[model samples]
Target: MDRPALGDLEAFLAIVSHRSFRKAADELGLSPSSLSHMMRALEKRMGVRLINRTTRSVAPTEAGERLAARLGPALSGLDQALETVDAWRGGPSGTLRINTNEHAARRLLKEIVPTFLSRYPDMALDLVSDGRFIDIVADGFDAGIRLRESVPQDMIAVPFGGTTRFLAIASPSYLERRGVPKVPDDLLGHDCIRLRLPSGKLYRWEFEKHGEEVAIDVPGALMLDHIGLMAEAAAGGLGIAYVHELVAAPFLASGALVAVLSDWCPEIDGLCLFYPGHRHVPAGLKAFIELLREHDRRGKLG
Candidate 1:
């Protein structure tokens, strides 16, 4: 049998991995129409229908699934081999994809990325903000950011920022209507702004003090998925919000929000940069990690 073209194989793999023509096109730096044509050509060459595409989603046929199961690891190995070769000659000259929460991304970009990009002009950085915990390897991310305590035990976690604490805050007007809580349980009587997790459950508010940890399921009139939106709702006097102190600092200083339960707010391990343990760190990730360390040393990360 004649060998399949490398481009066709790559396009096929990308489409199978992302399950979206537009997303695969963006990742491969190809136009959507071009990627579609490439897939059609590959399917014709293989003499089998590979993908089942509907208006809402895409999936692989049984034959395509078998091919993907065999090709996925081979393609991953090829990518690792290329990365290993690039590492030898590198002063950080490739794209680095990272998944993180919005707060962590904002903090890292403020102190680390600007200088690193200036030094390595050829390097590209792609940061995606996601609230849910994700498998970085499955998602094709080089690294991900999460709290130190949240990182998996098998992953290598490096501290990226200083300690953080949660603050219970409310607008003055709301506080006037419903008095401040003296303790965690008092939140049960208040109109709290609850955060909804990606898994479709309310986030439990956590607090620590004097070696005692508490998780409270507070009542609320509003529920939101995004932290920024929750903050905005709190600012609008909708309800009290439990959020990171750093996130509410500006509002607190400006008197738009007033923090309560300060004594219960406890310092906890900060954000961490974590990645798969088995995979070799790419030069781009190494450079970014070093940049973070340097920034930490200088006390620039807050």
Candidate 2:
């Protein structure tokens, strides 16, 4: 029997992983029609249908499922072997893709990234800032930065930065007009700047004090999606905003904003670098982890 082309196998895997011809095509940098043709050719060569397509979705057939199960490990092993070879090239090299929130990215850049980049000039860094949680392995990311609470238990989580606190802040003018909320319950009576999530829903303000946690549904005159935008609005006297203390520090120091319910604010575990435990981590990722650890040890992470 003639062996299938590597392109055909890759196309098949992409289609199965994406579950959509359009998505797979987009990922592979090929037109949808071309991807479809390739899949058809692959199926013909194998003498069996590998995918079941419908108007709304696509899925692997029984034979396709079996092939995927076998192919997944083989492909993973190939990638690992290649990475091991690449690691032996000496200094860390290769693009390191990191998924993180804007706040975490900012914090990391403030102290950790500069020296790391200077030390490993050959390594390229790709930082993607997104609010929603993502699967690093499935999304093809080298690692992800998120709050410790948000990280999954299966992943190895290393503290990337020190503890951080959340603050409820408002412009002095807004507070003078609307009055500051002394307690979490007082937030109900004030106009707050609300955050809209990527899922198109408002984020409820969360608070903790004396070991009691509370989620507050505060009324807002304006709703914004980005945390930076929400901070800007609060600074502009729009309303009270729930934001990370680090992001609000400058404004607080400049007297542009005033903190409310300060006694209730609690310090939580800061950003953590997490990755899948099941796979062999790339040398680039391993190097990054070491940098973070060294930064923490030297008290360089601020």
Candidate 3:
């Protein structure tokens, strides 16, 4: 049997990784029809049915799965080998894809992205904001940014920014109307803006003081998924919103929101950039890490 072209193999891997021809096409800069034709051609050449295609979804067949498993590592090795040549280029020049949550994405854009891009003009940063936790390696991402507590144990985590806290905030008018909650339990009587996690479950409001931890299933009519939206809703007097301090900062400064449970909401670990330890770190990613550390150090000093 003849071997498939390198590009065809890469396209197959991309399709398997995304499980969507359209998404793979977007990533590979090819049309979905073209990718489908290419895959069909690849299958014919290999004399195997590699993918199971349906109207709603696409998945690899058993043979395709085995092929993908082996091909994934081999492609990674090839990528690393090619990346070795980047050292001679005198600087990192490839794109670094980071899957991150919205809060971290905003922070990076505000403090780090501009400098990073300016310093490495040849490099590109692909920052994808997603609330749900995902396998970065399987998703073909170079790294991920999430809170330290959320980082996978197997991955190496580099903490950045600084320690951050969640604040239960409400508009002054709403607090005055509904009365302030002096303690976490007091939230039972007050209207609360609940957070809906990516897993389609409500996030129990967590608090700690003097080593005593409390989790509250606070009463609320409204539930929002995004932290920034929660803050805005609180500012609009919808109810109390528990959100990262960074998300609530502008509202706090403008006096649109006030922290109510400051004592209970102590600072925890900050955001971290995490990646798989088994693979060779890309030069662009290594450079970004260095820049991130430098920025964090300066932030701490300032």
Candidate 4:
């Protein structure tokens, strides 16, 4: 007979989205046991079982599903309304959640994040570094950062970080012992640090020269998932590595690694911040985009 608290409803939505009390608790900054008690209280207040919980799993009950289906859009509208009010107060103020790959995260930390946080004292940022592509809207992220080519067709993309390239690199010792690879075919005779994609497929080393494109199933005894790790292994003389130029930069500068097949690597379109075109852009996200554009203008001017 009493109205449920807004916080309680929001907590319920977080639980359903993650399908785990522990994860939802982490998101809400509450202990798992506390979250469990809150859910029990909510269920009692509503006079119905909302969540079906077992020792191994937790899921929403039928009633909970219907509630969530309705609550999702309602809460989103409420959030937008609140954000609209906040935007009128002057500068953007609130958390901006972004999903990005490791490389992009690193770049932001070095080139953008410090400036962003310093410039907007009222704003907070929640950055999730992930290798796999995800649905930003479903994941509740304001935006996502990935290579321009990888941005979804339906999303609006704002490019940054300039052009990037992948390089084939090896330690001088390794090249001296195994002979430098002259072409993509020559990689078959060398020990290489191969990459394992997030989808469980081994990434084929790709190269371009003039208009010719080459993809090689490079031979390797060492397989790594991280570009930095692959570059480190190559620098340690374990094997040749195919990695982003940024990943190999330090080693190359220090003379620990020498680039092979340099002519094959060509600059490509760079990283982009992408978001759903249909949704109203959050004030914090708009501020971030404006900053990115300012940086681009400065880069062009200099």
Candidate 5:
């Protein structure tokens, strides 16, 4: 059998990984039609049908799947080997992809990303906002930001932020009308603003005081997925909202939202930058980690 072109193999792998011709084409800096032409040419050269395409989806043929399984690791190793030179000469120069929640995107990364990009001009960072727990390796992400408790045990983890507390907040008018909760259970009697997790279940508000912890499943007039939206709802007097103190800072300062049940709010382990433990850490990832740790250290000092 004739050897397939390296470019052809790369395009095929990208298409198979994404299951979309358009996405693979975009990644390769080619038009969809161009990618289609390349695939046809590749198929002609190999004399085999490598992919099956429908209007809605694309999938690899059995031969293509087997080929991809073998090619994936080999190509990955080649990429790493190539990057080693860049690391030796350039210090760190590659794209870094991360999956994180909106909260971290807004509260944590927002402040640092610009500086990071300016300082490391060769480093390309892609921050993908996702609320669900994802396997970073499977999804082609370099790392992910999640709360410490939620990070997988087998993964290598680094602290992204200091211990943070949740705050129950509401507008002055809402608190006055609904009566402020003196305790965690008092939320049951008030019009609460609840959070809905990505798994489609309501979030239980957690509180800790005097070494005792409480989880409250309070009824709410509104349920939201984004923390920013929840803060907005509470500011609009929808109900009492459970929010991170970092997210509630501006609203509380503006007097649009007032913190309640502060005594019950627990200072919990904050976000972690986690990645698969088994793989070799990319130089790009090491630079990112160093920046994160520097930011964390500066925050502690300041």
Candidate 6:
């Protein structure tokens, strides 16, 4: 049999790697339907079923797995080789995989993404928003953005955001009806809004005062996964929301929510972009780092 075209091989490889046509299509810059059609065409020409597709998941057939086991490393090497050439050429291209949380994604999209995408047309940014502290190397991410405190010490960290704090907030009406808690412990009796972490555990509200720190597992009827929604719930008079001050700022400014226990909110290290220090930095990542630093210097990024 004749060898598959480079594009077809890449399409098949992406599908197998991601285990979802939609996700693979996103990486390959093609619509899922189009990618599906191409896979069909490729399978027809190759005279075998390359992918075993089901509604819930995608996987490679036996022959396809053997092909991928052989081809994956070689294509990766070829890609790395080309990226090295691009480093000398100063035209950063190829995919840049990033793992980050919703907060950082919002900040990047708001402050940096538009300009960065326009400036580096050849570069493809693949941002995955996940709250889990995933192992970037094991998960195949080029880099990860996380709160400085949460970032692994082994990775090289670059400051991407300034120090920020969480605030305990509620609507004026809710506070008026329930009365404001004077201390973190006072939250025990109140209808506090709660947040659930990615690990499926409830987020304990952290507070600090006079060199003493405490965490409270405040009880509440309402719980949410995202900070923005938590703020919105507080604004809607659901309950006291412990969330990032940055996300709650607009609601506070609009008089939709009022902050309390401000003294208890601890100031922590800001968000950091991190990568394994041992590996060679790809040109795309290098370009992004330079751009980020430039923006920070100009006082545009925080």
Q: Work out the TM-score per prediction.
A: 0.76, 0.88, 0.84, 0.81, 0.79, 0.74
lDDT of 3 by residue, 1-302 (tens): 99899999999999998899997888788999999999999999999999999999999999999999999889889978887877687678878999998878877888689988998888999999977788887677889999899999999999887788999999999988989999999999988889898889999999999999999998999988888899999999999999988889999999999999799999899889999997768889999999999987787411
Encode model 2's per-residue lDDT on 167-233: one tens digit a residue. 9999989988988788899988988899888788888888888899889989988998887888889
Residue pairs with clashing backbones, model 3: none
lDDT of 4 by residue, 120-217 (tens): 88899999997888877656788999989899999999998688889999999999999988888999998989999888899998889889999999
lDDT of 1 by residue, 147-212 (tens): 898898889999967899888889999999989899899999999999998889899999888888
lDDT (CA) per prediction: 0.85, 0.85, 0.90, 0.88, 0.86, 0.87
- Strongest candidate by lDDT: 3
Candidate with the larger TM-score of 3 and 6: 3
Candidate 5 Cα errors over 4 Å, as ranges: 19-26, 29-37, 47-66, 87-89, 108-111, 130-140, 152-155, 197-201, 209-213, 253-256, 277-280, 300-302
Candidate 3's error at 102, in angstroms?
2.6
lDDT of 6 by residue, 178-214 (tens): 9999999999999988898888889899899999888
Listing every candidate in turn, what is its Cα RMSD in Å to the true structure after a full C-alpha superposition? 4.1, 2.5, 3.0, 3.4, 3.5, 5.2
- Angstrom error at residue 299, model 6: 1.2
3 or 5, greater by lDDT: 3
| Residues 204-239 of candidate 5: C-alpha lDDT, one tens digit per residue | 988899999899999977888888899999999999
**Candidate 1 weakest lDDT stretch, 10 residues:** 83-92
After superposition, the stretches of candidate 1 with alpha carbons farther than 4 Å from their true spots are: 1-90
